[model samples]
Target: MNKLMLILLALSLLCPAIVLAKGDVNLTAPAKDQALTKLLMTRHSVRAYSDKALTLDQLSNILWAAQGINASGKKRTTASARATYPLQIYVMVKNVTGVDPGIYLYDPQNNKLTPVPKGEKRTSVVPDAVKQDWVAKTPAVIMISYSKPEKDLGDKTLMFVSVEAGAVMQNVYLMCEALGLGTCAVGGYDAKAAKEFFLLKPGEEPVLMLPIGIPAPAEPAK
Candidate 1:
């Protein structure tokens, strides 16, 4: 062997991870430090937002992170119980560029937003979200809904659906943080009112609402 090979072998004997090809790459630390921990440490619920508008790309990425098909075939960002994939996402487009103002169903498989045609009412989503002024101010609100059959999840359907919805929102929160945006989970809204505002079907259930927007400069990055 050459001089470099001999040196590498000697170093590997002293420190097993010292081999040049298998250098001391603290894999676990790198993962948490670079990815998970950074996001977790910085992630905060942002209810206040600026008047800035979000581009279509930003909205698309956020939606994809929430429920897009990222993996091979139908696998998504989050784990679905029994692959039921019960969640449906609806975007209330208020200030997104290039998209009209309306509630659009997110078609994950096709990666497109199909506009949910509904008559414009006198009142907006503000009242449905218990009159949270921020909801009206934000550029967009992502509503996570469920319309799967109960038989897929048995009698504990609500429980599973709730758990799954939590995952979806967590994905949204992280994605928003990464995109320099802000969002908050609003469970205080009237579910019945949300159903009417979003025009839900008989069996479709509204689970959670995420009011997303450009956060006003309040807290500095940690």
Candidate 2:
């Protein structure tokens, strides 16, 4: 048995969602000291975005902040259970410069984004979310799904994935704060609706969604 066959065997059991085609990586954020905590505290979820599209670099930085690889070998964020790092990051990009607008799966191992399908991200997950406006208003969103737990590891493994995702989500919040972006996490969406939308198989479950964009300006203090 070869590597590809092994992967196929594993996938047969897991039935991961439809994947995007892999492509070159775009790095957005500065190498270090991107922002401080106080600055991130001011970050809030914005419903409107500027018509001006986000640059690839900006998108890259935001995704990186969420769960990019760091320290040469390990991921930028911490994970438990032998670094299984079960959560996958998908970007539903509406108006990014240079890149085609669509749903993209982020591959941390390769630092690449794979295109799932044109318009799939927007349509598939939007209707399932309780806050439907958010899917349209924000220029981008982050979608999270988990890998099947290792056999006999039990429910504890699910908690591990949750912890890893929480850290990544906070990182995204902090980065948005520093970058003057708006974001909100929504877990109350129709998971089954979204799962079918993403064309996920039995083992993959859509767990979280985050809408991100520039906040509309505040009205004058009155």
Candidate 3:
């Protein structure tokens, strides 16, 4: 009907992968990601999670989807403004296969997690930060925070950083869906309080919180 829609129709006629989709156009996955079409449709927020611990592979993939460096070893899974990937990912590991209960920093460069010094004792603050008691029982909480100094990034630059962080969250959502795990992105937390909760440095600021684990089965009908 319009210029953009007409272009899409022409493309659909040319490419089998560009078939018409219900609801929205982006729901159509590319040729390689047929499963992704279904995954995108079914993805939903999962708040109530089972206490079962995740396998090492599953845990690794979740973190990788968040900020793992790609096979190229030069670019990350998510986009960064000017390649300045300033978001730091921390794992509040209450339960996981082989990994001990502690807070670990995701080293995207090496694809290994390093324990955050004195991080084990700081997790009691999570329940308060997320304002949910059930988070205390979730297997892991992925914490994304802005680590660059505010003065250097400034207000406008931080806008780009926030957009970058959002892309990271979307990747996590899709990854969790594909792995049969569940996750929910949480906002509305007090930045100062969340910063203290993560034990961040003076200039670091917390951005987003994600609680991920196996979804609890729905209650049976009475």
Candidate number with greatest TM-score? 1
lDDT of 1: 0.83
lDDT of 1 by residue, 1-222 (tens): 999999988887987666547444734344655776778778888867788888999999999998999868689998888888888998888888888888888999999998887823212588745578877878888889998754567888888889999999999999988888888898889988898787777889899999889988874453
* TM-score between model 2 and native: 0.73
RMSD of each: 8.8, 20.9, 7.4
The full ranking of all candidates by lDDT, starting with the best, is: 1, 3, 2
Q: lDDT tens digits, residues 88-146, model 2?
A: 78787787778877778887767788887544535335665554664566777788788
CA lDDT scores, all candidates in order? 0.83, 0.70, 0.81
Clashes per candidate (backbone, < 3 Å): 0, 1, 0
Q: What is the lDDT of residue 204 in candidate 3?
A: 73
| Better-scoring candidate (lDDT), 1 or 2 | 1
Residue-level lDDT for 175 in candidate 2: 79
The TM-scores of all predictions, comma-separated, are 0.81, 0.73, 0.79
Q: Which regions of candidate 2 are displaced past 4 Å?
A: 1-35, 117-124, 219-222
